[model samples]
Target: MDNSKLPINQIIARINDAAEMAREIISEANIFEAIIEGFNEAEGTNLKLTDITNLEAAQDWIDEFLEKYSDV
Candidate 1:
């Protein structure tokens, strides 16, 4: 698809939409991890976590989760 034909406002709007989607995905991943940890704790079992691609990816998720609560 040739996006150059679109207006500048349309391009900016698309960028914003993509960013919002990325933020939501990061937030959801963080929430999922928390829920899994809580369930494991409640069951009195060891919770093993797999490594992400790198530290940056992990930090992104943590940041988004913290932003949701305004506390980190």
Candidate 2:
């Protein structure tokens, strides 16, 4: 089947739509990273928040938790 049978304007519209969707997905990923980073930085500074019984494992735990919860 030849796509040329369709109007050029319609093909352009579909391409533009896909591009817009990609941009939106990228934007959402950025926002999610910002949220996770903000939480990590804020918690890192607070002695009480950062002070876990297992201090050696706390940072890893926090990072893993944030990464898990930060979803699209």
Best by TM-score: 1
The TM-scores, one per candidate, come to 0.57, 0.52
Residue lDDT tens for model 1, 1-72: 689999999999999999999999899878767854754565576544464456687677557645654442
Give the alpha carbon lDDT tens digit for every residue of 1-72 in model 2.
Answer: 466888999888888999999999899656655655666675674334424567457658667767876672
- The true-versus-predicted C-alpha distance at residue 1 of model 2, in Å, is 8.5
Give the clashing pairs for model 2: none
Q: All candidates' lDDT scores?
A: 0.70, 0.67
Best-fitting candidate, scored by lDDT: 1
Lowest lDDT 10-mer window, candidate 1?
63-72
